[model samples]
Target: MVVLTKRELEQIALPAVQLAAPPLALVPEVDLSAVEASDAARSAAARAVAKACEDHGFFKVTGHGVPAPLLARLDAAAAAFFALPQRDKDKAAAGAGGGSPPFGYASKRIGDNGDLGWVEYLLLGVTAAGAAAAPVALSEGAESSCFRDVLDEHIAAVRRMTCTVLELMAQGLGLDDEGVFSRLVLDRDSDSLLRVNHYPARPEAAGEPAEVRRRLTGFGEHTDPQIISVLRSNDAAGLEMSLRDGTWVSVPSDTRSFFVNVGDALQVLTNGRFRSVRHRVVVSSARPRVSVIFFGGPPPRQRLAPLPGLVDREGGRRRYRDFTWREYKTSAYRTKLADNRLCYFETTATS
Candidate 1:
């Protein structure tokens, strides 16, 4: 709950060495407009989604029905908010004594160990069960009011779109009911987080060694701890994912599309059929970058385990033990940002 000031952030040093950039590969794209088409077309789109989930655990989505204008406004609002003076931004800081909500502004040096990223973010809860929660409150002022309005509108639209994608994913997984996934994710009391991230351009490290130059990261490598994440990033080229062979590939930045990533919860629910890929963002030295991510998880009280339907099809063996979302999230927050949080909840047969 500790918040670092701008001065403290500036004092943090970068790692002496950094990993080299990996080869670039395109993430598969799925045209979700098909979901509104005929049954045959819907089936085709579902199959494509299933394949992408099984093979890459990451993909880009197009024709998602969210208005481009809404995205632009959201982007503008974010840019305006982040451009504010440090003291103004600190008013929304999410830390002990910050007076902000639990899921609010977080600066660099996210962990107690001073593990830092070249980014700052505002996290807001988007859903409680299927219903929309109250819009995030902002300090009373004309500017804060406008920012709040735009963000609320954007969050509402994105939440609806995310649910649609989840339904299509369920269809592709042969869970014809579609509600199976949606029910688990959108249940009343289900907690979903919307994160608005801003990564400022790094200072040029002229003539520095490749390792030293690569040490600048917008955010470090890590897998998400939710059911799924829907992300949209401005054109800056930083997102990268690790392949099964341990090679890294840069993710394409398509402003018109949303990037979807399977998370640890989904991997467990699928009995590892889908992977939770490790990914990171490299800081750009020229222009600042902004991203909006919606992280979906089950209700805090819900116990997550391999879905019985999936387990039965996979010879009835559970790859992970049943654990409440609260328990898992608690464990996750206790560790370093990049650590494999899922390992703590793993259960062996003997246990």
Candidate 2:
């Protein structure tokens, strides 16, 4: 919310001279079009996904079948909603109940420490039954009745693509049950969250040197707690990932493609064969950026552990202990966003 004026936006805009060049050779791109093609083609695509998951836990996806017009419409709607005043945006707030899930507009200050990110977001929950249980209402000032319709269509399309991707990943891992991954995520009670993020330009800090101010981050480093996350963003680059070597690589913003990242749950299911990506968003002085992310997880009551098949194949060693989605999520929410939530669930042998 908090409709920012042109002058206010400009005040936070980073100067072009301070912008860093995009990093190279970070994450590879996988073509989803090959997923349903000939066996050889599908296998090749699966191999690419496997490699990306094992090495970086992140990859870009093209030919995902999401219409360009639909993506544009979703972006336009989000921009319009975020441009409204704070009071107007709060009409659909997550509500005052202490037990409410984090499912609506979350402003800058979040976490126990009141850490501030230069971003604001609207979170909507979707179930396997169909679209969001409570569909997001378009702000009246948005002046477009079609906004909600387009958004719903977009969410539906992405969910289909998410399931397909999971199937491919399962095949890539040599799983006999092709639907194992898909079933875990598409269950009727699964909590699939769609987050629409708006990262405004960084404001100039008085009396601080330009170099020092440029070091501020929009969001601190962290890994997702779900099975996977699919993200689409505008051309303003800010996302970065931590490599195994401890180097941080910037991910170029490519609006036409979706970036997929493995999450903690997937890592456990794969018996640590796959990795969970640790990444962060850096604030830019250029222009404000917008991104839409879909995070998929298992049903709240579903017990999660390294697959028995994977464990038996790997000398019967379990990397993580069995835990329910409810337990994992509770632990995740109780700590700072940047903390490594997976550490809390590691098997005692590994610990």
Candidate 3:
């Protein structure tokens, strides 16, 4: 487990610009079924997904079989969790997760360098047992049992979808059909963490016009560093990703679909075959927004590096030096999260 001191988190540098674009383009609403069959279609899907990943590192997935009822229940539960009074929410604050760096509630505006994003969060991690251990149920009282049941179902569905998408990525990268998923996601302690976020609209003053302060929000530009991230956002739009040419594009929640993005860890395991896009959320003045993300990855101590096959062969010689995933993550977690320089190192370790 890792713990981030207030001083350490306070030292991180925010993006130089307040609103920056991500590094790619977004291929909105892709059908999961269309890409699951035939080598040719899979190849094409791979190419398209790869291109989108390379360009923006983020895309929208649709036609996934996750039941709509599940999504509704999850969303409602998320709302209930965030709706708790500040005091109740603080009961599960970050430090309570036995010193784990990424769990529990995190208030907005506490990040390094005064980067003020308008959101609060409660983070959860899943173990191989197929369910996240109940660190602290929303409420021990039965009134919130529905929240627990619905959230449990939603997590299961997200885990399944995560495996399906990762398998496709493996096939697209020309590895064995079950390649990446098995290697990157160890069944026992794979990271299937969840981040339940609340992006509050900018507060209005007593008599101040509400419209003037309506456009504030939840987060700033960044990318997930894990394998894949499945996210569900409220109607308010603030999530944005970067493009290859350096433009940040907005990713809005559509219908019942969840937003998916490739993370830095996957890029390394695939030897840079895929990319992790930069993204951030903005605060709003009306209607608070809540989002939950399921992050996929190996255990904390797993050594992460680009697959040798993707490294040495055709194009450029191996681009990064091999390093343990935990080592790299430790550095990232210890320092400013924006510094991506060390994530790609070159060394003569393994093939």
Candidate 4:
């Protein structure tokens, strides 16, 4: 990974200037209940998804059919795990499933680059077995067993939802193969991942109000490098997305729903028709914030390019040059979080 200069890191960590949040209803919301409905209703739902992808690249989903109790269990498990002492968490890191850089627990530091944030997270790779083996459940003890069980069940449900939306995306594009996108994520060698983030509350109890203090960067700005991201969070909200005009707006916190966003890979696959929404999390509240994201990625060896159907051949050549998923993933890992990672792979003439 390219190391960032201290100056660049400082620039990235500068306090975020927050704008007033737009109305909640302004963000597009799609009801996935249509997925199981009549063909006409499904078609309408698909159209809605397509329009949202083109216009905002960020939206919410309702009637997604995920079990409420299961989500609650995972939330409770996450809370308990975060509440553990620093030493305990550090010890649990050993069981975080070894890797080159290692997949375990991380705090403050966002990446190999000098990027920093007021956040701590557990990064775990999801496998063909359908789950991520993270720090919490290493032993066969009851507590450990319960944590792994709930985490696994939660991922299974969220993974299904993620695939459903991917299929919807294909349908929205009027593709004959609705599974075109979903199949990549469902592949046995898919490089999916789960990231559990915890942004602790400000240490100040009796100080200036939240508004008086400058906003702290929880997670700096960036677009996910996968195909799609399904996010679940508690009531606390600090999420923000960059509008097409480069304006940043607060995302309304919805505890009962899931927020889905397009990623860089998806943008490439669609020939840049769908945006890869740039987003960040800012610390504006004193309450601790917890969020878990399921990133749906394809197999490393999978070749990535503009889908022939999505590319308007009559108009011109593809927007992005052909490359394997592994190539893109490697390039992403070697860049700063806020960099336009896709710029390296785009066709100069097309851009």
lDDT of each: 0.75, 0.78, 0.65, 0.81
Give the per-residue lDDT digits (tens) of candidate 4, residues 155-250.
Answer: 899999898899889999888899989999999999898888998774452366644655667898999999999998998888888889887788
List candidate 1 stretches off by more than 4 Å.
Answer: 1-20, 94-102, 129-139, 205-212, 348-351
For candidate 2, the 10 contiguous residues with the lowest summed lDDT are 92-101
Candidate 4 wrong stretches, greater than 4 Å: 1-13, 16-25, 99-102, 133-140, 205-207, 349-351
Sorted by lDDT (best first), the order is 4, 2, 1, 3
In candidate 1, what are the lDDT values of residues 139-213, reduced to their tens digit?
557878777777767766667777777777788888747876667666767777778888876656455554555
RMSD of each: 3.7, 4.5, 5.0, 3.8
lDDT, residue 36, model 1: 78
Q: How many pairs of residues collide in model 3? A: 32
Residue pairs with colliding backbones in model 4 are none
Residue 99's lDDT within candidate 1 is: 42
lDDT per residue for candidate 2 within 1-351, as digits (tens), equals 334455544444445553553465457989888777899999898888888899889999999999998998888888888887777667557532221557667776555554556678877787575465564644554453565576668778988888888888988999998889888778988878888888876655445555555633566678998999999998887888888776778888899999999999999899899989898887745478899998888999999999888888877888899999999988888888778889888875632
Q: lDDT of candidate 3?
A: 0.65
Q: Which is superior by lDDT, 2 or 3?
A: 2
lDDT of 1: 0.75
